[model samples]
Target: MNQIDLGGKIVVITGGAGGIGQAIAQRALASGASVCSWDNAPTAAQATAGIASMQVDITSEAAVTAAYADTIAKFGRIDVLVNSAGITGPTLTVQDYPLDAWLKVMAINLTGTFLCSRAVVGGMVQNGYGRIVNMASVAGKEGNPLQSAYSASKAAVIALTKSMGKELAKVDVRVNCIAPAMIESALLDQMPASKRAENLAKIPMGRAGTVDEIAAMALWLASEECSFTTGATFDASGGRATY
Candidate 1:
């Protein structure tokens, strides 16, 4: 189609303070989109104070609904929503994994996505146009050891993207996801070096992905330029993922 002009558009990005999230926000801002950046804490001032900043708990439907209300009240429309807030549960096998931590990760990475999508769907249906880019991880596809919760949660995200995409296929909202391999972020420090090195070795590209790479994919998915692809997993695995 045409160039992806996010100019004058309104986009809501959860987890906008951290690496990938911050990168996505910067790209969107550069394209001229008014971004509503949400994290568990306060941020967005440095990136661009003009952008909206809100403290959000992704698992809280009430909080999400209120956030959407604020966005609509202020901007009058929601053009895009990016669910990037997530966490990796404790490093342990399924047998030793704590139920509480597992539940928490699932609630945020999976359920939180459900809540935010539900909150935004109405406005999107009303506007007859919307784009959603959910973040899944290569961990979900390859099932890394010591990361059961994170992998499961992201797998659910992939499934949810497909189901939601089909549900809204005729309604003008497009839903898609990116399954990225290990990236250079604070998240990497949580893993043991051996496991991390093993992962890096698998990538034919021989390195971790950068936040800008993921952000660039998000920009296209959020753009009108990305048509005919929905409910699909776009890979940014640095050649690590094989089928």
Candidate 2:
């Protein structure tokens, strides 16, 4: 990985126990940032020497607030926040999608992001610097069939990033998101065989992306080099994104 300095920055990544979140934590440590993972299953995070872990349920207001407080107490401050905690609800047609499932997805994917970002923005503003990298999806850009809840929640995340980015434009807090196509991870394993096949067929690269590739893009967005770019959606769709 090409070096992008994040020395001395404190980064908190939701869902840091696994998948893309875990990959980003590794990268952040390598880049010299103090790392913390706020995951519901904190123990799942790799037992690394430099990384801190907090058990947080991002969907609960109280849980998120307490977790943020714990993070600040442990690291002194938060410089970057990665809202990567989300779940893909059961694949079904709109009419057949369970209301409970829809609500759960919205609660975790969208509401959780809002709570975590809200918790950190004040500190960032006070300190005059911040970076937020939200993990959205290509499903939000081009709606994936049978994944209404997932698509809608991610779409909201993209919009939220835009709004927050503009609101803090005068300050140093930059907010952005990544729209990745089908990635080779447990999230993909959640899909049925046919659904996975259909999604991968859309990528011109003829394959799903790796966690490392997504982490690399996220690392850049969380760095000082990302200055001048905010409220933007970076596409990591492997040639699937046209706009």
lDDT, candidate 1, 4-101, per-residue tens: 57988899998888788888887898888998887787574634556678888879988998888888898899899999988877888899998999
Weakest ten-residue segment in model 2 by summed lDDT: 41-50
Score every model by TM-score: 0.94, 0.98
- Largest TM-score belongs to which candidate? 2
What C-alpha lDDT values do all the predictions have? Answer: 0.87, 0.92
Clashes of each: 0, 0
Clashing pairs in 1: none
Residue 32 CA displacement from its true place in model 1, Å = 1.5
Those runs of model 2 whose alpha carbons end farther than 4 Å from true positions after fitting are none
